[model samples]
Target: MSLFTDRQLTALKRNGFVVLSDVVDDDTIEAARDAFWDGFPTDRDDYEGLTTEPERFENAWEYIEDPDPFREINDQLFPYAEALAGEGTLERPDGRIQVTPRFPTGEQTEGDERPPLHRATGHIDGYGPHFDEHYEVGYYTVMAAVYLDRVDPRGGGFTVWPGSHWYAGDYYADHHLESLVNDATLPAYEDGEWTRGEALAHQTDPLEIHGDAGTVVFWHQNLLHCGGINTSPYTRLSAIQRFVRPDAEEIKRDAYANPWKYWEGMDGVELPSAPSER
Candidate 1:
C-alpha cells in the first residue's frame, strides 16, 4: 500500500522534495521536546540569557543514548520515510537531532535582521568538493528533516535549491567520481563552487522552508541545502535522518553507479523542467 498520495509522489519527483505536514502527533512532538530539555545542561546563566546570545548544537544523538526517551519520535516517523523512499530502503534506524536556540543577542535584537540570501552552500550529503577530514562519505538515500517547533522566515528554517539534485547527479557523473559511495575526493574547488554556481546561472530560486510543528521534509540525497539563519525570538529545533536504499551495498561497490538508479519506479518519471531549460 502507498502511504504517499499522487500529489506527494509528483512533488518528490519533480521538485526533489516533499513536505508531509503534521505527520506526527502533537503528543509525540511535546514528548521529544521535553526529553531534550530535561537532558540539556541548562545550569549556565548564559543559557537563559537568550537576549544576549544564540545557542546551536549538532549531534544530539548523545543525549538520547541514555534512557532513550526520544526513541518514540524516531520510531513513529520512520515508517513515513520508508513509504516515501520505497520498501526495503533503510539499512539502519539511527538519526541525529539538531538544536538551534535562537534569541536576540546583544549585537542583534528580534526582527533585527532577515536571513541572508541563499548562496551556493550547495553540496550533496555524503561526498563532494566539500569533503574534508571532519565529514564522512555518506550512503544516504532519502534525507528526512522533522521540525519540532514553529518555523517562520528568519526563524532558522531549512533552505534548499529545488531541482539542484538533478544537476548535481549529472555533474558528479560528469566529473568521473560517480562510482564511489562515500567521499570521492576531487580537485580543490572554491566554496559553493560547482552546483551552487550552476544553480545561480540557471536562476533557481532557493526555498526557505517554513511550517508548523511536526512538519517533515524529505529531500533527495543529491540536493543542495543548508540551515537558514535564526533571527526570531524563539529557538528552532529539528531532527534529521538519512535512509539507505535497499541496494546500498550493491551500489556502493559499483564505481560507475548513479545514485538515482536505486530510486524505485522513478526511472521514467518526468521531472519538472530545470530553470535553464525554461
Candidate 2:
C-alpha cells in the first residue's frame, strides 16, 4: 500500500516536507523514550545547566551504545521512507540514530525577549564547516525526524523553510558540485549563504513543526532548516535519520540541477520556476 496520498506527494514536492501523524503508537513511543533515557549519560553535570548550554549535550547518539533501541519505531517508518525514495536507493538503517534533544535554553527566562523562532539558525547540512570531511553536497536523498514526545509550538520543534529546495537547486545549477566539498574554498562558504538569502526572499516564512508523539516528518535534502529553541520547561526529544540513494554519486550533477529528479512520485508535478531575479 502507498504510504502517502496523492495530495501528500504534491505537498512534498511543493513544500519540501510532509508530516505523517501518529505513525508510531503511543506505547511504542513511550518504550523508545524510556530506553533512550535509561542509556543516557550519567556523568554529565546538572540537567538545568546543560539546558542552557545545549552544545554540550546536543548529540545523545554519541553517548548511547546501542544503535537501534528504537528499532521497532524505525520498522514502522521503513515503508514510508522506501516509498518516498525508490527501492534500493535508500540506505539501510544501520548506524546509531541521531538523537537530537533540545533542552530548554532559557529562552523563556525573564528579561530575555527574543522570539522562539528567531533563535533558529537555518542551513543545509553535510556541506558546512565542522561537519565530517567525508560528507559532500547532495549527499542525502531525504531526511526523517521521528518525534518521541509531544512538541509544542516553539518548544524545540524542527523548523523548516518551506520550498527552499527549489531555491537551493537554482543556486547549485550554476555552481560546481565540488564547490561544497571544501570549506576553505570560497564557494563552499558562499553557496549556503547565498541559497539561504534567496530562499528567505522568495519563499514563505519558516515553519515550526509541532505535534504529538509518534509524528514523523520527512523532508527533501536541500531544504533549509534548523532546530527550534526550547522555551518551555520540557526537553524536545527526536531522532533524525538521512537516507541516501544508492546511485547518488552517479547522478549527482543531474539531481543537483533538477530538484525533483530522484523523488519517486514527483514526476510531472508542476512547480513554480526558480525566481528569475537571482
Candidate 3:
C-alpha cells in the first residue's frame, strides 16, 4: 500500500531523497548499458578509453559472471524495496532479502574543474574507510540507484545535501556510532573532513540528481550524498543498489540512537535540525 505518493511520501520525509520515474525500461536501460559495456576494455568510442580503466571500474560481477543481468535489475528494484520495507520485508525466512551488485562507474569530468559544493563529500551509505567499521543501524534501510545512463546537467549526478538527511540523522543522534569512526575521530562527520565543511556549516543545498534511463533514486540510510562532478559532456552510467531492513543488525550498540528509529516510512515527518542543533 505504500509504494510512495503522499507527495512521494513528503519528498521522502523532507528531502532525504526520492525519484522513482520509469522504473526500468528504456529497453531495460539499454540492456543495462549492454551489461555495462560488456566489461569494457575500451571502445565505446573510447570515452577516454573507458574512463581511464582501473579494470574499467570493476564490480558487475567483476564483469559479468552473469546473475542473469543482475536478476533483471533486481526484479525492477524489488517492489520499491518491498514497498518500503514492509510486506514481510523481502520475505525473510531468516535470510532477509539481499541482492547485490549495483556496479558500473565512470565519473569523467576533471578537464573542466567544477568542484564547487565546498569540494563535495556528503556521505553515509555504509560509512567510509572503504566501509565496514560497522555502522548500519538496522542493517541497510535504503539506498537504491539504477540509472544506466542519460543523466544530463553536469552529468555525474546523484549528489545531494537537501535537508542533509536530517542533519545526518541529527549527527548520528548525538554522536557515538562506534565513536564516529575516524577522521581523527569525528573530525567533522566521519573523516574526509566535513563534505564541503558540513555543507557550508549546515546551510544545505547541493542537489544535482538529474535522470532518464529508467531513473529510480530512493536514498535515505541517513542520506547526505555525493559522487557528482562530471561537469557535463556525459559519462554517468549509475547502478548502486542496497536495501536491508528485515532481520538487520550490525548497529554496534549506541543503544539505538534514533536515526529516525527504524524509519517506519518516516512516520509523521518534520525532523531536521542537527548541525550542532542548527
Task: Output the number of the lDDT-best candidate.
Answer: 2
Sort by lDDT, best first: what order?
2, 1, 3
What's model 3's overall lDDT? 0.57
Q: What lDDT score belongs to each candidate, Candidate 1 first?
A: 0.60, 0.69, 0.57
**Per-residue lDDT of model 2, residues 67-110, tens digit only:** 45567666777667888777666777764677887777655642
Q: Is candidate 1 or candidate 3 better by TM-score?
A: 1
Each prediction's TM-score versus the true structure: 0.76, 0.80, 0.31
Candidate topping TM-score:
2
- Find the 10 residues in a row with the least total lDDT in model 1: 180-189
By TM-score, rank the candidates, best first.
Answer: 2, 1, 3
- Give the C-alpha miss distance for residue 74 in model 3, angstroms: 6.2
Question: After superposing candidate 1, which stretches have Cα over 4 Å from the reference?
Answer: 43-55, 65-69, 94-113, 128-131, 134-136, 178-203, 246-249, 252-259, 265-278
Segments of candidate 2 deviating more than 4 angstroms:
42-58, 65-68, 109-116, 128-135, 178-204, 268-278
Worst 10 residues of 2 by lDDT: 182-191
Stretches > 4 Å off in candidate 3: 1-34, 38-43, 46-69, 72-112, 118-140, 144-163, 168-202, 205-227, 232-234, 242-260, 263-275
* Superposed Cα deviation of residue 48, candidate 1 (Å): 6.0
Mind giving the per-residue lDDT tens digits that candidate 3 earns over 156-204?
6777776566555555566655544432112344442344333332345
